[model samples]
Target: MLKQIANLDQNSGNTFKLLTDETGCCGDSITPCKYVAAVPVANSVSAVVVKDRDGNNQTVTFAAAATTVKAIRDALVTAVNSVGYEDDGNVLPGISVETVSTNKVVTIVGELIVVSLTTSGGSVAATATCTEVGICEFYVEWGGGASKVLTVNGVNATLGDLTFATASAANVKSALEGAANWPSGAVATVVKNTDDSIFEITVTNAQSTVAFILDGLRLTRSNCIVDYV
Candidate 1:
């Protein structure tokens, strides 16, 4: 997600993002909307099974004594985030859990792929959603310089981490395609636009919108530029 450079709102779009699962969901019917997970109800023991970045089932358990809304919310948030950030040490992609409050009622808000949850009565659940997509595109403009080194995400080679002073579209195509440094899927084709400066780099993936943010907000940008759509 190569967003705006200068904008009033930072989170609006002026952010640098990376792709994780090229076949992931994108707010479609097949998957439920974000923040739609059922509110957890405590039982003799309560747990929610969620899919992690690697499509692995991770279970977070809570004691039966923890019954307050805040207790549940805090525990859930901490547990979900901890798997991705703390326990995994940010090595794995973790589910993002958030909260929204109105008056005094707090709602668990986030894009979590809920599997199942147990309660005193029976069970409750929230469904996950994903869009049907198969392509990932990158629009880049290399600023002119000598021995220009551009780093996209992490791979510092052609396309992603390419070290080039001035190269043609063909040069860029080979770099990105040959490197195969894309989300999780492989590369399909590298097209050269009319400008002949590598206008767009298209990637093909089964997972729709190519969801997932890069490891960090860090980018060693010397001449690489991202054009937001």
Candidate 2:
């Protein structure tokens, strides 16, 4: 069976490019951008419990019945960072909250574990949990299906086992960007088309015919796409 792309080949000198649906040109081409997916907001009210590396617990509660996802994320970051604000001590001190991909994904710099997630007040929802071990494994593919199983982390993690929320594609982007194995100058990004409910990932590099796989799906020229999980 096909494995992670990294196992199939090396980063030999191939150039990675993004194709446009409107124009057939790869890279340096302007394609009329549309929304593949709208940012996923909180469907029901919820609460998220964050446990930092220090084992400190910070609870952020969301009461909005149907608020923008961005608002919830901002509240979470603010609550996690506030000092002497309330009984819930700062869950992540000295750890910066950095948001990527239009605030869809928020990472607590230095490492913070999401212990429990609960949604209540208006409606109950599952909490957002982070299983980040500072490691990520990706299978990148290219022309003729040449591929490789690339690993990047402090330790050896299970290949193709890393998973995250589909609404927050930035989680995937953050994982790839956080890893060290990605070739220099090669970067990964996510885009949403307004017309559909899909999230497409593109890796652009001056050199390297790049495509990758996560969660058993192959991201290639033929199918470099993602959807709400």
Candidate 3:
């Protein structure tokens, strides 16, 4: 017996029709042998709408059962061509994405200094009486060449006294492993060494050539680094 099966619509916007039938052998004169068979046919169509750089919208249509990946890609190319960036024939630069992980630290070869620092989290006060302070604030600065000001609490200080935090040898080595100040360019995580005294900052950026800057107190930058990629 021949039967019409159900139709299927795929998420890719393709439609398919299914048909089932019984096959008969050569002995039909007396009695026919039957075998089940299934057949499928494509019948769907799709269209793509894209916006050109000039803010114009374009449409590309695909015929029923005739849409190929290559054809769709070509249509997209054409649609994109319909618009230009800045009215200048040149194409606009694609957004840059990247991940960066680095360690920043302020090292004292000798005497300790008092300072005040601010971060996204809060402010930390460092006094000359102490040898070290814990990392508190993590700074994240995005976009190349962008300057940011981080207020540090201090009695009396000058720009020259401003320095990136310095990590001990152990901290420097482990810096990439732990969570640090991750900015917009990337995601960051810091891991502590097995000894637990050292840490590594790891950063991953989705795009290339992106960098992040971390600024804060000694405790803040203890195991963090500026990520540039």
C-alpha-based local distance difference test score of model 1: 0.39
The digit string of per-residue lDDT tens for model 3 on 1-229 reads 1121222231323243232122243432211111111111111113333332234544444443223334433432332222221111122111111112321121111111113222222332322222122222333322111122223222222222111233333333233222233233344455444354434444443232223333332322334322212
Query: Each candidate's TM vs. the true structure?
Result: 0.30, 0.27, 0.23
Clashes of each: 11, 22, 39
lDDT of 2 at 130: 29
Q: Give the TM-score of candidate 3.
A: 0.23
Better of 2 and 3 by lDDT: 2
Lowest summed-lDDT stretch of 10 residues in model 2?
Answer: 30-39
* TM-score-superior candidate, 2 or 3: 2
Off by over 4 Å in 2: 1-42, 52-58, 62-66, 83-109, 120-229
174-204 per-residue lDDT for model 2 (tens digits): 5556655655555677654334544466665
Model 2, C-alpha of 24: deviation from truth (Å): 54
Highest lDDT scorer: 1
What TM-score does candidate 1 get on C-alpha atoms? 0.30
